[model samples]
Target: MPASRTERLLNLLIALLNTKYGLRRSELRETVYRDVSGNDSSFGRMFERDKADLRHFGFDVETVTDLGWSEDDPATTRYRIGKESNRLPEVELSPGEWTVILLASQLWERAALGTAAANALRKLQASSRLTDVELPVGVQPRIKPAGRAFDDLVAAMHAQHPVSFSYLAGSTGKDEQRTVEPWGLGSRFGQWYLAGYDRIRQAPRYFRLSRLTSAVTVLAKENYAPPKHFNIRAELDRLPELPLLTAHVDVRAGRLLGLRQRALAGTEGHTHTPDAGYDRLDVQYRDVEVLAEELASYGPDAMAVAPGELIAAVTRRLRAAADFCAAPVPAIAFHDQPRAGNVRKRTSEDQLKRMLQLVPFLVHNQGLHIQDVAERFGVSREELEEDLQILICSGLPEGYPDDLLDIQWEDDHVYITQDLDLKRPVRFTVEEACALLTGLETLNGLPELAEGGALESVTLKLMAAAGEEGLRAGSLAGPAVGPADRATLDLVRQAVSSRSQLHLVYLSPQGDRVSERDVDPLRLYSLDNTWYFEAYCHSAQGLRNFRLDRVQELQPNGNPATAALEPNEGFPAKLFTPNDDDTIVTVQLTRQGTGLADDYYAERTSELPDGGLLAEIRFGNTAWLPMFVAQHGGSVRILEPRELADQSRAWIEASLASYGG
Candidate 1:
């Protein structure tokens, strides 16, 4: 039978590790390569690729050439993994440290780091020597590094390659092609930024991920090294905020309360068009494009009167939205793909990766309960026994009793007598290091978790253990969501813990008014960078979520919580709870707005030919549909409930007509 890739790699690793003197090409070909059939040239190429793959996994596969040779000769070169270099140094973690790590590893919910974090946690669990302890569940915070650009940049940084993308310059509002050596990606002020050397400008620059107008093209042929000891957060913090520009806008009377709230109190003036039912307001903004997008979302309710660029931008969006909503869409053939089963199927490679760490772990900690080991590895007891069975038969090339790994599980207690040269776990790979380190730093920002100095201590220890490459891999940093909303979160947490009713001065989502209410806090959770508190409100007589940022004041109402309610198990993960009365609306999403399906929890979705999406989503009412369409610019267009689409088109056309479109 032809040997599987997993079996071949394992046998080769064992043969190389067991050799005192490195094995030459011919010797390896006769041994581990015996099952692999190929010509000499093919074998040579395959061996080199395998060696590189091992190196990529942080295994130090060293090549020893003939003595006195100036250059490596393929015939004379021998390869082996040095025991001291390949094995990870023993890491001891306290219970507090372990608990913090567990929390940090769960920080990345949907980002590229999510998978990396899970794998890192598994390896850590295998090697952990600390006693297991449970932690009290609190607000489960998560950071979502959304968008394809984030994934592309992270991959490029891992490979030490440059990236090319067309960036929309915030200052000029023009698209410019940029080649950047992505040194680090971090978030600041609720937005993701890439700090790198701009090859086009021949200088260091920070580019916001949102402004990237095209798909990122990784320049694999080109590579560059980042500055040593670079601190991404520090550099991003050093950047000055953009200068604010004053913009004059007209708001239809009794509409766009959110825009009116930001208006200069004493700067109210007469509208340019008399009897147009408009109120003039002066507003301060940083970027014209950003402000334009916001103003455009109000449709006919708001219009930028001054700043020709702002007017032009808003006009362009309104025109596009009007046309998009009025256009007809072809009938879509909807089909549902079979959902994957809950049970995970373990592949040979997965089994191999686990066993590689499992043997070393068993060696260090002997006679562990079989169930305990199974739980740690997230596998069934039978599956774990299968792993042990396979492991006992795998060993050095020489088929001898003493050459193989000895493992036995009598009385449901497992022990490993021999582990060959794999007495320690392998060092952390780049992705593994990045996931943990970045997660630790992100967790450091939470006010609740930051009270104890354990987070900082763990971070320092991880960085030291990670070494140079690991430290560099931690280039992605999440936005700081704790500081600004710290006070509000502290109060909400206290209320939830005490089961006390609290008085709150909160602004309504529509921004039309502010209301005072006494509520019982149920849970505190976050999405992206915003903090939300789910509670039962006395005024509304039902459950409601209040944004921490929108709270004007919070105080104890001097009453024990009267409402008898329990938070759902999945409350923290869900942003919206559907109601029977909710309207089901269908909309078309452009390529750029496809993320909305996941964000809004679409009921159904179908892919369109032009990389767009046809999504059926539910909304509380049709009142917000026009704003949703305008907010996403032309990326989303209403397609169903024909009346709603007509209303949206009319709303946008009215806005454009005001701008003389």
Candidate 2:
């Protein structure tokens, strides 16, 4: 009826002839035009029309004699299309090419694709007739840029024009107005960076597009010339390596030593000779403060050996940290404090009541297990189970078969075998939204998170959930917390979750101190108006704790997770005890000495029952014990351990005799 339809029919006939070799007129009528009104046309007219269409369109349709039919019985005429009809070539693609095609199809969003590129891909896929294989769940490509900044930059590059933007240097907290000659945009390590010459620095610099606050096209035109000496791969090779700083100092030989060797290999130019019994290693970095902070994490084992300048820099930082620790603690504020009128409105009885309201939907809709759901929602498995039991009793229609509830449990696993008419999808409450927004906003301020848009998306979602009016009202309500504390909290949370040891410079009553420790992070909780990490220390090889407010710097230790502990093990709950027949060390103290001992041993000291000061202490190694005891002077005396007593008395006598006391 229409030119397009006639053309399609002719193509279909040609395809059939090529595939089936030949088709009888009766068979063609049944298969091709079975439900069409024109199929009843006289055989002679249909044959004439077919012949006219084929000849007009340059198709070679021909008649072939039926060998089994006699001349008198002319009922078996057969038609065929030319061999040229089947001449389409087979399409072949290499693995790499196929990979590129698939990547282009999946990762590059519609806005990023050119019309030609998109059309070509679709045509190629149709012609090839490739099998559609399903990608595994959560196998999404990491190609979404922060927003449209990257896409716009790419468009500018294609148009061969310069671009202007305000950029922030992460290394130095400096904002510079910059204009760059367009070169090219490329992706490296899951980040999109634009490589071009900086108009201000007069050198080649790369700007991560995601970090660009504002960017626009510039009218300036410049010849495109890549620097002869520029080699992106070579420059990337010299970028600073992530420093490995840990608190647990172990000198055992084997893979641990190998790891230390690898960490210090190229940086040996900065090390000095070992200080007597102690081995010394120095690492030079562009950021000495960062390196010093890393070294201080090693505590007693790794000291910042030299380059007085770096040590001074670290010392300056430690001073600032001490100031923070000395500052008065802030008051804890709670949201939605119970009002006088609302006391009788009734609230959830306990954490169990909250869990009961939250668990069933998470199990059935989110497909989460009891343990995972517990960790994510910050609850326990027992609490989750209690909620599930309550949920099992909640259903419509009141009884047995008519009830809208069904659950199946097998091998310690649970499944919601039937649907329940739940009205709402899981969501965060207003207070939860506020907390999440504040946390994400804090994370977004960190240097490490600046390159990833994940935090930005989270912030937007939080704001949307708060509603426009509520968000505006909250913003006007003034600041609830500062960014520095938030950053510290985020870093500690990451370290704990990752199970990586940390290097921190801790400010104690005794000047600035640095320590590296292998910590079995048990919990992070606030105590006595300060934040503290309760952990099992590998260096001390005992249960130890540290004040977060005193922590100045934090760094990751790049050792295997298993190397730090036995698999799936938790921190010991009790205080450490010395072995039997081990030297029992006792110390006696005078009035002034009592205060010092009490301050140091406040948590572990016993009253002695007889109203005497006989404080007991244990040491894994006694090399430095004498020096520590001698520091207390005349007010201190050893009460037990004959050898240690004699050693300490001799050291004290020697010091006093030198002073002519």
Q: Quantify all predictions' global Cα lDDT against the true fold.
A: 0.76, 0.43
Q: Mind giving the per-residue lDDT tens digits that candidate 1 earns over 129-234?
A: 7558554334567776746578778989889899999887867777899999998999876668999999889999999886776668899998888888687877
Tell me the TM-score of model 2: 0.28
TM-score quality measure for candidate 1: 0.80
Candidate 2, residue 84: CA error in Å?
60
Every model: Cα RMSD to truth: 5.1, 27.0
